[model samples]
Target: MRQKLILERTNEIRCELNKVWDITKQYWYPLFECTREDLISFDSNYIMKSKK
Candidate 1:
């Protein structure tokens, strides 16, 4: 009975992780296309703006 409960909980966690993965893949694929220099520049600008 305890093992069955653990298995169910594991399956729930797997389903949540899959959902997160799908969302990240949809949203983050474009970021992956960015050049390293572009990412660095963006990050620096973001940091500078956030400090204000």
Candidate 2:
């Protein structure tokens, strides 16, 4: 019974992680097309703006 409960909890955690991964992929997939320089510029701009 203890092992069964542990397996059930592990599956629950896996499902939650899959959901997060799906959402993350949606936002990040587009950035895959960005050039390295574009990403660097974006990172620098974000840092500059956040310093305010």
**C-alpha TM-score for every candidate:** 0.33, 0.34
Candidate 1 matches the true fold with a TM-score of 0.33
Candidate 1, 7-30: lDDT as tens digits: 889889877965554424434434
Q: Which candidate's lDDT is highest?
A: 2
Tens digits of per-residue lDDT for model 2 on 1-52? 3544588898898779656544344344345443223324246677899999
As for candidate 2, its clashing pairs are none
Deviating ranges (above 4 Å) for candidate 2: 1-5, 23-52
